[model samples]
Target: MEEFTIINENNEFKKGKVISVFNISNSNREIVLFSSEDFDSENANLQIAYLNIDADGYNYISQIDDEKVLKEAMYIVKDMIEVINNG
Candidate 1:
């Protein structure tokens, strides 16, 4: 797994790890699976999110959106994963 810190357009930061990646059928897009930790919570449970990535960039299929932030996070996660797998 690769650690990452993704910041939204509102400047909110989410620290997590790239748990996995899924390819979408009939499309040139991929889903970057992530698991974030909520440190403020008592239990510190893991939060999961799926970010979509294409040629243009990344975006989440939700009302809270920021393509630029998602794109940067995806690139970082992808690079880290590739390095680890190749090594």
Candidate 2:
């Protein structure tokens, strides 16, 4: 459970733990999902973020190529967080 320091658009800094890092099949790109304690406007407990990675470096924000991919990541993170909380 590695943690990272994130700086937001307001220049606010937050500390979060890494939940998972994964790559889609047949793709060289890497995506990292992390959890922060800060809640969004909706007040979601687990604030999940994905970093877009390329050959050059990481992009500030990431876009989902497919809706299924976003859904899959949500499921994966949910399961992982469950294990961490209940196990």
Q: Which candidate number would show the highest lDDT if scored against the true structure?
A: 2
| lDDT (tens digit, per residue) of candidate 1 on 1-87 | 377665656776666666675543433445556665544563332333445545776455322144654555556666767899998
Cα lDDT of model 2 by residue, 1-87, tens digit:
276566767886666666567666644555567665553543313454446646786454455676676777677777777999999
TM-score of candidate 1 against the unseen true structure: 0.40
Q: What is the C-alpha lDDT of each candidate?
A: 0.54, 0.62
The per-residue C-alpha lDDT of model 1 at residue 49 equals 48
- Checking candidate 1 for backbone clashes, the offending pairs are none
TM-score of each: 0.40, 0.47
Clashes of 1: 0
How far residue 7's Cα lies from its native spot in candidate 2, in Å, is 10
